[model samples]
Target: MPALGIDIGGSSIKLALIDHHAPITIAASDHYNQPSPDQLTAHLARAATRLPIPPDITAIGICLPGIMAPDGIRIERSVNLPALQGTNLPDLIAHVTTSPAPRRIFTDAHAAAFGYWSEHPLPDRLFALSLGTGVGACVLDNGQQLLVTARSSGHFGQIDVGPCDDPQPIGPDGGHNSLEAYIGLPALHARYGSALAGHLTTLTAADPPLRALVRALRIAHAIYRPQHIALLGGLGLQLAPHRDAIKAAVDEHLTCIADPAWSLHTAESSHHAAIGAARLASA
Candidate 1:
């Protein structure tokens, strides 16, 4: 039987059905952009009902970009989608699905990393960085996710290396190039809006986002010592053309280790999180 996986993020929602049998395959899939919780829930219900083999959906997995209550039913805080805060996602989902399939939930980063791990079972310790509305990461050791409870995720976006004089506010600010500001759409737009088409024509070593990304990768390599580091999400994939450039930047900055052990790869699957959800549910 296949299990259903749903991934809710800051800007998009995606769902897929995965058969965790001999050859894992996606049986069905769908996506929506920036839908409210109620609208998104109804769409999922409808999508599940219309599946070619609806009965094949024996279990369901949900991944969200926020904190969940201990009971696992309520979303205590949806960081990007504020409306989902203090709402019970599963109960809302149950209101729509006909069979009320057994369900599992995961954080977005954790789910994406898990999905990648399922597809490529190479290195035991891996780090997955999800970059879009925000940058986040998840660490997996021997296929097991760590820091997955309510507020324990590896929020790498907030990681600061500077020595501050006083407590500085963290978030989007145009003065300095924070990781999120450079990668997030709003900041990127604000910085390059005047020359949107002009800037993209020639992305070089000067791009702050690209530089910050390289720095982040070096830091990750030092800390996690992961065998592989996978990058996913809208903006993350957009940076694919500059993969070689990013590598060069890393080499220039890395002092202690000439070449890091981890191999960097861009995650290409649109159904990654959903696939991960289904895999976990089947397990």
Candidate 2:
């Protein structure tokens, strides 16, 4: 038996078959891009047909970028993908996965953190920042998600980190000079142009986005005191090569409560959320 893991993004859906025997192993995987709201079910069906999904799926884990209802069946809001608001995702997925097993829902950040923690379990408290289309963060305390607010496990991106030169704020929340306004994809593109990815190696504390990110990391240290802080997702993967520089910058204005040995890492898997969803469902 194996479980199905689906990670729905604003424009893409990533699927993975996680082996029940080996929770962390991905047996199969597929990616569908730019699916409109109406096309989601169709793409899911295509994934089911293309991937060799087992009939006896132990569970299914679905994660997305949103604030989930307490029951986890309905999405209350998704700033990056408003179309998903109030959508009954499990019902839509039921059309493709005709399983009687439980369907678990997870916030994308929580899934990424759990997935990263599953692979690296030593740190009892882990803080993970996901830098992608939008920024998100998750803190896991002894393998359980630590909810910072009533609606979200971690709303780290919405916090105002510093002022920006842009006339308008960059995130959907309309918060001025939020952390997302500094390092989010759209913000990065606006700041560095189309060749931004190519110029990541040249970024340092002098760069506005990197400087804001370091400030956010320092804030995380003061708040969570996490033993491990992981940087993951599209932008995070790109910044992996410059981990030392980023870490050094974060340490420059480090808080006294922050652990001197607190480590930073870039999650190796591109599909961390999907893998985490399936692994968590298996639990």
Candidate-wise lDDT, in order:
0.67, 0.78
lDDT by residue (tens digit), candidate 2, 53-115: 678988988888777777767878878767677888777687557788888887788888787
**Which has the greatest TM-score?**
2
Least accurate 10 contiguous residues by lDDT in model 2: 25-34
Decoy 1 TM-score against native: 0.80
Q: Which stretches of candidate 2 lie over 4 Å from their true place?
A: 22-35, 40-43, 69-72, 164-168
> Whole-model lDDT for model 1 versus the true structure?
0.67
lDDT of 1 by residue, 1-283 (tens): 7777777666656667667454444432244545676776666566555544355478888887777878877788765666577888756566435556788777777778788788787556787888866677888887887674454446677665322212322444232335665555544566688785466546775666566677777787777667777787766566667777776776775756433555677777766887888788878
> Candidate 1: which stretches are off by over 4 Å?
21-39, 42-53, 148-153, 161-178, 193-202, 255-259
What lDDT does candidate 2 reach at residue 151?
A: 35
